[model samples]
Target: MKVIKKMSMTMALIAASATAAFASGQQAEEISYYEPGASIESIVVDAAGKGQVGNWGLGNEYEVQALLTKYGQPTTYLSQAFDMDGFDDDSILLASAMTYNELGLVKNSYDGGYSYGEGVSYIDMNDEGVAMLEDNLFTTAAFAAENPETVKAFIYASMKGWAYACENPEEAAEIVFNYGSSVSPEHQAYMAEQVKKLVETDTMGNMVRDYGKMDEAAMAQTLELAKTYIKLEDSVAASALEAMSLEDVMDASYWEMAMGSSGAFSPEKSEVSIQLKWLPQSQFMGYYVALDKGFYEEVGLSVNIIPGGGDIGETTAVYTGQVDFGVTWVSNLIAANAGGMGLLEVAQVYQRSGLVLVYKTN
Candidate 1:
């Protein structure tokens, strides 16, 4: 049986090859490694013939697909995402794991976990330069244009909530747990810790003090990836997707206004609703923190956070005016506007991509 180790920075650098063909603003792929006596070439060779990989559908799956395709390997999707049984049985060669969620289960011995410990290896999208931005705050362009004060107030309060969550992850986890976390208590705590890393770290592994500030370089890389991978059925939408500039999808002015203003604010809209990308968990602790910590109230806003995961997507909900703002990946926001939804991202939440591909070692 083969043993897998968790992706370690300590992995020995044996062989390395890089390409300049990736999106602009993306760092060159510096290194790829496996366990002792293993090379990236060997792993790709094995993966090519095996053709077994696992990922949830949509952007994350696309990220994995892009990476594997770059390696010249066949991408055979798994029936289920995050299937630990398949990972342990070698039925799946690579399984998608988000640092904040599925990775906790993969590493912890708690319920619904494999407890793989140091026996798993992973390929990081950030390192590979295929990373797409995740978890942004966005609304329709009309909403933002019509209600600048409301947008600024929301951003100010939300960034404060994220700051609190990052500083006190354990408490943030508990707070989210109280809000009906879908995962177990232990996993929730693990998620908070991991999410803190994502919020406070940049793709280049630099520590970021400011919360919710969009990194233009990272956004550019994300846009390039979205344009490369995302294909639209609507010909008009496809043309829009191809023609999308950074300005079409995001408005940094709102974030700038929020950051420049004093903590005091009077919102034009006193009450508003925002949608989450998924069910309650530490993945979205910042918003919960804002509500629980009275940051939203401080801004004179009553916020209703609608949980996501139904037929209606977050982008659609915001575009259709079901919510004033929504938390979604940057790619989703771009695709939404390209489809003529006119969504505009107000702030970026997760600074680094949390997606990784986990596999066992020989």
Candidate 2:
């Protein structure tokens, strides 16, 4: 599947507000706000189209629009300029915050955070049933078909890495920090804690021990959401997207086979490289931990991790043979497959969605 460098940004006018919602001098323990499960209707309707919402425009823009429309609220999409400053000034009343990244920044005071304490609440996409799958393991169909053992080996090592990372987040964060993290050390540690939640938690807020096993229900939901949001300009591609099924984009056999074995697979390719979805951070700490812990080497593979965030995306890089495997969102793989790249997702790394609509309650 051919993937674009970035998703198209939806246009909207950003509304600015000078209202300060928090007193930074207050102790964190003295503050409290709405519980996390607060209804979307409560926040969106109250905003009344004046409190502008922001998204990073990776793919969660669709989820934001879907939520607003579901609640019978009309909103123009805000593509960028979301930060703690935006929240402090009330210029951005609502913004997309990933649990592993932005959410950590919003809650952490040591790393120049908002320090709003418990005065903020969020709408989780997973709970709303509008979540699309985030980070996943994928490769071109031809690559997997030609090198099944290598694929299995990679999956085995990768999942082992993930399991370890989830169990020992602090050490995993330290390992990633030593690998040259893109965020601060404190923020990286915070990310490691939050990322463990995504990796091991389910949509129902239940803890799941399966690290990289593909959840069938979640995958179907993601495919359905992708069909609704991933717009293709090419008529043929658009048609392909509508007609695509989970089978067309995923091959669970490799994940299954890898899980069945206790690190006993002999790889056809001893040396392989993977491209990540973004820069070096605890968000992708599993791979770094796997490399650091010698999990890849244990599986008879020498894995090279290529940091992402260049002009090319992980899907495009993997599709063009720039990398043997890649980490990307399920929606991105769907779009690429619609364009006929035939990329196959091997494993779903993140069990739950991390995208949350964060806003202040007072």
Candidate 3:
């Protein structure tokens, strides 16, 4: 594990020395980002040239906003209450589905049973170059400052859980399946297997030797996507683009503790809550593994894991202090920073982008 050299500056710098630095904002330094680790997670939007232009939404996900911007498609934001697969069967021209979740639903259609492999043309976000980071652990700058040790404990346990999941994907998938409410056993299992490729590799398909390490180049690219595609309602999300140095926004000091004390799990206690970006699934198998393995308890902490959904805003909950921590995408957090929320990336769980695009081959 590499040493994470964290700056000791506190959030007070925001109103004090940091204020001066922002006021004196000069020529921004050329950010030369590092691309390490390899993960296969990518979010892609499905496209079709053969059908009519009528379409609905990808549950109005904030992530869908980026895909929409990239594809330049007209859309209607609708409720998930409608059967997504029904729309597909009705010949909706273009739509988006997650590689881990929705795509599988269509592929293994409960009704018509049309598999994605039959007639679908898929566009991988990484292949299309509109990808963004997903499933990163974050906390407010103030929370990190006040609870550094707690943060480290959570990251440490989570890293262990991630290693376990990467090594034992089938078991990991079962864990996710048990957590399912609206999801299917087969789909959960499928997500578990596919998500393994994403969690174990980086955006460039390079093998990620370490879990929870930030990929600088990949993250920088993600910021660019947010600025261009996810700004929403004519908002540029400039703060995401003009973010402070990596050292300022990503606090890796906790990583050092987890990496150093590989065998010695903390027994001293604390309590915290982590709100995941989406519902309980293989995407967050690591966190669940940690909880199942008693890693959180071993770390001397009691953790409340909250599941998120399309309607749930992890950023808003975190900003309002609803949770001590939150799991969200890279763009979401950076844009939150732009909105003055001060959410900082503590650990990057998914080294690759999970965004994908699907289209008809005919």
Candidate 4:
């Protein structure tokens, strides 16, 4: 892994001073917006005609706003809920679900009918969710069995990219910050440190090399626990179990071919456009690479990377074919499949979950 050293003390101090100055009412000049006769829908259609995957390239911003509206509050509620001093488990779960939705990994009715007043709650991944998750995994594996080479290649590439991000925090942070408009400098630095800690301390290192590899034993154990602990509806069938296998669904070789030997996956070159949802940090690097380095052009892809503000529903986008692909957590994928979204796990970007339950010091 290539190490990018942190900012020097002098530079840090200068940045801090600058930030303080900005915070004290020395506001940055805002860009003027002249409304064009063209609507966002028209721009998106034109971009799509030219090979852009995401509609208007707006990405998760719309989803975030929608979620906030649904919650009857501002999106800042996430940061507030994360503060341990005012922690609310119920809020966290709803926030997590909302984030998952924005990432296009789950579906929810935003009719203002769902209760948001519940204090604290937990999605007991105890038995039922676990079983469902495992069932989906096996279904995926079974799909991959017919195309082992493809599955292996995709998994390998995904694992490689994920591992690289995990191993190099500063570099990754730089990539993300360059593209993520929502991430402030302080948050970027904090996220980088957090990712580093998670990767170094968790089981991500062990799973990195085994990118496409799935453990049958682990899958079985997970399934058993799911069945034993949770309530599964009668709708779940035995046939679904047979279809759920690690070997059934992954198609890494397809991605390998798509990416080519240069390791740049471009959707611009292809006549078909692919929608892409970028994980927070990964989204940054991906956008920078696509826009700055022209990786999208190189791969014959016109990519539109949507920013996730922890409130977009990526799974819904995929299900609706609004976007071709999205960056999301594994659990969302499980839920998506269960909900009958023909979504597949093309790659595992983060080896370990980045979701953390933070508490306030006060």
lDDT of each: 0.82, 0.81, 0.65, 0.36
lDDT of 3 by residue, 254-292 (tens): 676666675454433387888988888888888888888
How does residue 261 of candidate 3 score in lDDT?
74
Tens digits of lDDT, candidate 1, 19-54: 334322122222222464566546655654556667
List the candidates' TM-scores in order: 0.87, 0.87, 0.74, 0.46
lDDT of 4 by residue, 60-88 (tens): 12222332333343323233321222122
Q: lDDT for model 3, on a 0 to 1 scale? A: 0.65
lDDT of 2 by residue, 144-228 (tens): 9999999999998888888998889999999999998777898888999999999888777888887788889989988987887
Q: Which one is best on lDDT?
A: 1
Kindly provide the TM-score of model 1 when superposed on the true structure, using C-alpha atoms.
Answer: 0.87
| Structure candidate 1, residue pairs in collision | 4-119, 4-120, 4-361, 5-118, 5-119, 5-120, 6-120
Q: Counting only residues 3 or more apart in sequence or on different chains, how many pairs clash (N, Cα, C under 3 Å) in candidate 2?
A: 3
Query: Which residue pairs in candidate 2 have backbone atoms (N, alpha carbon, C) closer than 3 angstroms, thus clashing?
Result: 1-336, 1-341, 1-342
Q: The CA-based lDDT of model 4 is what?
A: 0.36
Off by over 4 Å in 3: 1-83, 109-114, 232-248, 263-269
Model 3 TM-score on a 0 to 1 scale? 0.74
By descending TM-score, how would the candidates be arranged? Answer: 1, 2, 3, 4
